[model samples]
Target: MKTLLSAIILLSSVSAFANCPEFKVPKKFMARESLFSSRATDMTFDAGGNRIAKIEERLLSATTTFDLYDNKRQKIATARQRMFSGGTEIEIKDCAGKIIGKIKERVFHNMFDIYSKYSILDATGKVIAESEKKEILAPSFSVTGTNGKQLMKMRLSTFSTRSLDEWVVEILNDTQADPRILLMIPAFKTSADNRETEK
Candidate 1:
């Protein structure tokens, strides 16, 4: 029974949006996830069904890192995480080894509001975007650009189950940000959410 249940969970991860006709079929994941592990690893795709990028998250000792690669499997960028008692910070560097962007969790959120906020900054220290959990019941985040407009979102697929969390990252508006930077938002949010859950 345990093996059967595991099989079911594994299979369901691929069809996280199976019941949501509005989103059509979900992007199939190429990673093998354990029953309760929260590590973020998967291949993302665009609406045209073309492979967008691949993300692999790893946690070792005090550091957690996520590597993003292009469809050709070439390293595009690396996000190295630094965890703090108050919040978390992730530094993103391109393949050329230059810092490009940063993802930082806000230390304080509104006491009355149920939101965990994060800021996305460019290398020059300009706030480029913001991310926050918008859904209370489940994991769903809204990424808004500096203009205070929604640029993208990351949410669990409609058919996602408790055993496995299948995520769907969608871009809602046009933007000039690097696709790799935008793509890592889901994994970054996952890491932050997982850390909060542990605490």
Candidate 2:
């Protein structure tokens, strides 16, 4: 009876430890002072060793990115991406893998450089169907207030659950168009007013 109890306790401890992130600070990355420059300091895994989430703090910019994965080793979701500097850009596609949505941010210069972050939402405001920048023009609507009127507007955001058991959060407008049409400027930039059929 004693041996059996000991074995059960040992197994429980192992299970608890496995769920925790195998956190490690790389020697080279740790030398940097920028919090934003730091990479994912923590990574949690499931019992099968599949990555669940990674937490990384940004130094250059005051933002954080959380990368999430599905059980099949597919990159299902990411909390942020624009500041990662040419990091892998993930797309939300349909069963046919059509480009339903995207998440990306870019730095541009007028006299000074403008950094913008945006995420595109679907009509239902559940899925982050696509992403774009303010300077870029999408296939949909044009931003033209009445000739003499400056029609400035903002939108409310909503979240959606994917078939893969992943979560997608988005912001949208009141109209029933693809919420991706709305451009959500990062807090750093001035707010700008704001897809898809599945296979």
lDDT by residue (tens digit), candidate 2, 1-199: 9999999999997676445232221111101111231232223222223333232222235454443333344433334334356332323332222333444444445654333434344423343422333433211212222232212232211221121111111222233222222221221121111001121
> Among these predicted structures, which one has the highest TM-score?
1
Task: Write down the RMSD of all candidates, one decimal each.
Answer: 13.8, 17.3
Q: For model 1, how does the per-residue alpha-carbon lDDT over 1-199 read when each residue is reduced to its tens digit? A: 9999999997786465233211122233322222325544443444455655667787778788888776677677888988778888888887756787888886555655456678888888788888887655776778888888898777787756654455766667775455666666666665555666767
Cα-lDDT of candidate 2: 0.30
Q: What does the lDDT read for residue 170 in candidate 2?
A: 28
- Score each candidate by Cα lDDT: 0.66, 0.30
Q: TM-score of each candidate?
A: 0.69, 0.24
